[model samples]
Target: MLRFAPSPTGDMHTGNLRAAVFNYILAKQRNEKFLLRIEDTDTARNIEGKDKDIMFLLNLFGITWDNLVYQSHNFPRHRQLAEYLIQKGDAFYCYCTKEFLDQKRELAKANHQAFRYDDDWAELEKDKNPHPVVRLRAPKEQMGFHDAIKGDITFAPSEIDSFIILKEDGIPTYNFACAVDDMLYDIDFIVRGEDHVSNTPKQILIHQCLNYDKTMQFAHLPIILNEEGKKMSKRDNASSVQWLLDCGFLPQAIVNYLVLMGNKTPCEVFTLKECMEWFDITKIAKAPARFDIDKLKFLNREHFKRLNEQDLAVLLGYKDSAIGALAKLYLQEASTLNEIREKVDLIFAKKGLLLAQYKESAKTENAEILEFESQVKTLQDTLLTMLNQDCSKTEFDTFKSNAMQNSGLKGKAFFKPLRFLLTGLAHGPELSDLFPILRLYLKDIVRN
Candidate 1:
């Protein structure tokens, strides 16, 4: 079994989603059951409704799980396991006060040495303190595990201290709760970020103390870095999955880009289902992956182009295939749906001629601004007349011909004003092409 255990914190980070993608793909590839474990034991830090938000994001990306479990629901099991360790002499109650431990930690820091809890406090009588935390009696022997991605990792006994299992408030710490639950759920395969490498040895100690013999496979993916080569954080707007979706990135494209990062893939672009056919967790690189927005944009555009015309139109807030085709024309210049939508909206919006800009350019060329305005008026009048007569039969070439003849202007002088009056832009796709697709709306275009 494979499990994705995410805490109910704030917005889901891209790095976290990447881990989920890997776990989901690996489970499908091996035909194993995938589980979603919401690690909400740390209630103090969890946000309300964030768990639902996480599930929604996972569903949006098509990452399905076979089982759903919340860590908080297993509090009784966690406490039961802690008590078992204490009764078996593998753990003991530590009656050390907070101030005393703080002093010891400070002294260790002053001596430039790492702090390891001394078991002297465990010898205190149980009646001496009403509230005490349970600490595992860590073995002073080397602990090691073979990671699928990092391979053969070992931790010295000194690095594995007698960490707390259950707090004075009866709350299980992360490692304790996670190890017990993994054992209970029979999760054989674990895939998570490399930040959890330090906690692996502690959890290994927990499993050993409990005498759980089942071997658990682990793969710790490398960290994702920002453009500045530092660890990506939530502060970066692009680090959040919701932010990426709001920016018009397709869910499939996001998955494709994430799976392609620091890993070898069969091709540049593929859906989650296609990726499942060939994904190999062991083949992923140990080096950190960099989040490249430009690469994601490229992949998003590729995925966008694969959509059918009607579907694309619906995404752009339209139901007409011609509008979809018109939007596709801007694909050469725009990389996202929002960008293309803006371009299409401009076609229907009232013309916003840059009169100040045109006047400035006219002054630079020693030409009359009034002459330019007069030519624009002439073209508008002629086009409106043509539309009034027979809007359906008006061809772009013939329309331009009549406008140039009536305005007594030619080339850029005539075409520039006409283009601005129609599309409100100095330059864009050829009018001959744009006009035909926009024929249905010619009356509105010319009159407005």
Candidate 2:
């Protein structure tokens, strides 16, 4: 089983969603259980009602999880585990004040020494005060494990800190609480970012103390960084998921970009369905990746272009109410609501400069612009001639050759003016391509 444990902080940002997506895809690939656990133990930092937003966004992005769990609800279980560890001598207590710890840290820094709470005073502190902040004991031997992505990670056991497992408030610290919850939930595999590498051995010790039947596997995915190659956070402009959504980025495109980041894969694009087919934890890149918003934008544009018109309208927030006003303006002319919608949709889908601008510009007296529209009208008339005559390949070829000669123009000179007249752009889909859509307009003198 895999669990996506997010602390309810602010909104679920790009980094948050990326981690959740990876876990979701992994569980889906394996056909195993994927659970959502709200790690809201940090009472001060946890934002009220943020979990609903997180879950809602997850659903919007097509990421689903199994049982919804809350760590705050499991406080009693965590307390029981802390008590068990203390009784078994795996954890001990020391009543070290904040001032004392600060002084020790300063002295250690000055002396070029690793700062740690003096365990020699453990007994003395316990004797002076019955209630002490419990600390995990690290054995003086090298402890290590192989990471699924970043392989062969080993830490010196002597360098490990026997830090507070239970704080002065008697609340279990993050590391201790995480281990207890993982054990209770039967989470045998932990997939998280590589930043947690230093905390792994301590967690392993806790797992050992619990005497679980099966050993847990650790897979630390690489970090997602900013373009400057630093860790991305809410401070960064592109860090928020809302920014991407606002920029017209499809959710799948964002997920696809994140999935490939710090992971080796042959495919360029990955859909939610496709992700389940090709997910391989072993292929994840050990090297950290810089998050490129441009890549995300390109993927999103492609996704947007591929979406059907109905889906695109919903995604773009084009409600019928909004289009109703336009329908009334073109009521008599428009055959149905959909017909007017189709034109409005096609117009806005390309570029959203005013429709009257293009329509009026098409009838402009300027020679350059007039000549262009005239040439386009001529081409349309020629094509109509061919369609009506049932012209063979040779006849059409001769006509194209003669037309090309008389036009005395090629490339943009031919296409640019035509595009400018029809779509009010100096560039667009090819002239040959536009002929199909413009056939009716070409015949109708009113459109001209």
Candidate 3:
């Protein structure tokens, strides 16, 4: 089994989502059961409904799991396992107070040495204090694990301290709860970010103390960095999955870019379903992956192009295939759905003409600007009347031909004003190309 264990602390980060994607893909590829474990043991920071939000984001990217487990629901089991360690003599209650430990830590710091719990209080009588915390009697031996991505990571005995398992409040610490649950759930494969690499040895010690013999596979993906080469943080809005979606990025495009981030792919673009066919977790590079917004935009555009006209139109808030086609024309200049929607809205807006915006373009005399507006008004009236007629026999070329002849204007004078009238923009796709896609909406365009 493979598990994606995330805490409900805040908004899901892109790095977190990437781990989910990798885990989901690997689970599907191997035909193993996928699990979503909400590590909500740290009640201090968890946001209500944040767990649901994480699942919603996962669903948005088409990631499905076979099981859902919340760590808080297994507090009994966690406590039960902690007691089992005490009975086995692998752990004992420590009567040391916070001040005592703090002094020890300060002494070690003063001596320029790493502060490890000396386990001096292990021999003290439990009757010394009614409220005490449980601590594991960590074995002084080398601990190591073979990561699928980083490979052969080891830590010396000095690094593994006798850490706390149960707090004075009787709640399990993160490592204690995680190790017990992994053993209870029979999770054979674990995939998460590299930030947890240091915590691996502690969890390993817990498993060893509990006498759980099942081998667990781990893949600690490298950290994701921003353009500045710094670690991506929750404080950065761009790192939030919801922020990216609000900015008009398709979920498919987001997943595609994430899967392609630090791994070798046979092709540049693919869907989650397609990724399951060939994605190899072991092949991911150990180096940190950089988050590039421009690269994501490029991939978003590619995914946009793959959509059918009808589907693409629906995304732009339209039902008409012609409007969808018109939106595609805007793709030459607009890359996102929101950008294309702005262009399409201008076409059908009740009042989109920017006469003042046009006036700014008239760098000449005021009389020249007045003349240009007068000409535009004259042409607008003429086209509104002309388009209201049959106009069925007119193609783009012939339509412009007739408009030029009737307006008694040619070149920029004829084409420029007509372009502004039709699309409400000083620039866009060629009129010859735009006209055909927008043929059905010509009357509304002119009226707008």
Candidate 1 lDDT score at position 382? 73
* Cα-based TM-score, every candidate: 0.91, 0.74, 0.93
> What's the distance in Å from true for residue 207, model 3?
1.3
- For candidate 2, the lDDT comes to 0.69
Candidate 1 lowest-lDDT run of ten: 349-358
Off by over 4 Å in 2: 123-131, 319-448
* Backbone clash tally (model 3): 0
Clashing pairs in 3: none
lDDT of 3 by residue, 1-448 (tens): 8888899998889989999998888888778999999999888899999999999989989988899999989998888888988999888889887777788899999999988887876545455567889999876899999999999999998888888999888889999999888988888888889999998999989998888889999999999998888998877777999999988889999999999999999998999999888898988999999999988988888888888889988988889877877887777778777888888888775432476666766765588678768777878877887887766557988888878888887887887788888888879998888887667777777774
Indicate the residue-level lDDT of 177 in model 3. Answer: 92
Regions of candidate 1 where Cα sits further than 4 Å from its true position: 123-129, 352-377, 389-395, 406-409
Deviation (Å) of 239 in candidate 2: 2.0
**lDDT accuracy of residue 63 in candidate 2:** 85
Clashes of each: 0, 0, 0
Instruction: Give the range of the ten consecutive residues with the poorest summed lDDT in model 2.
Output: 439-448
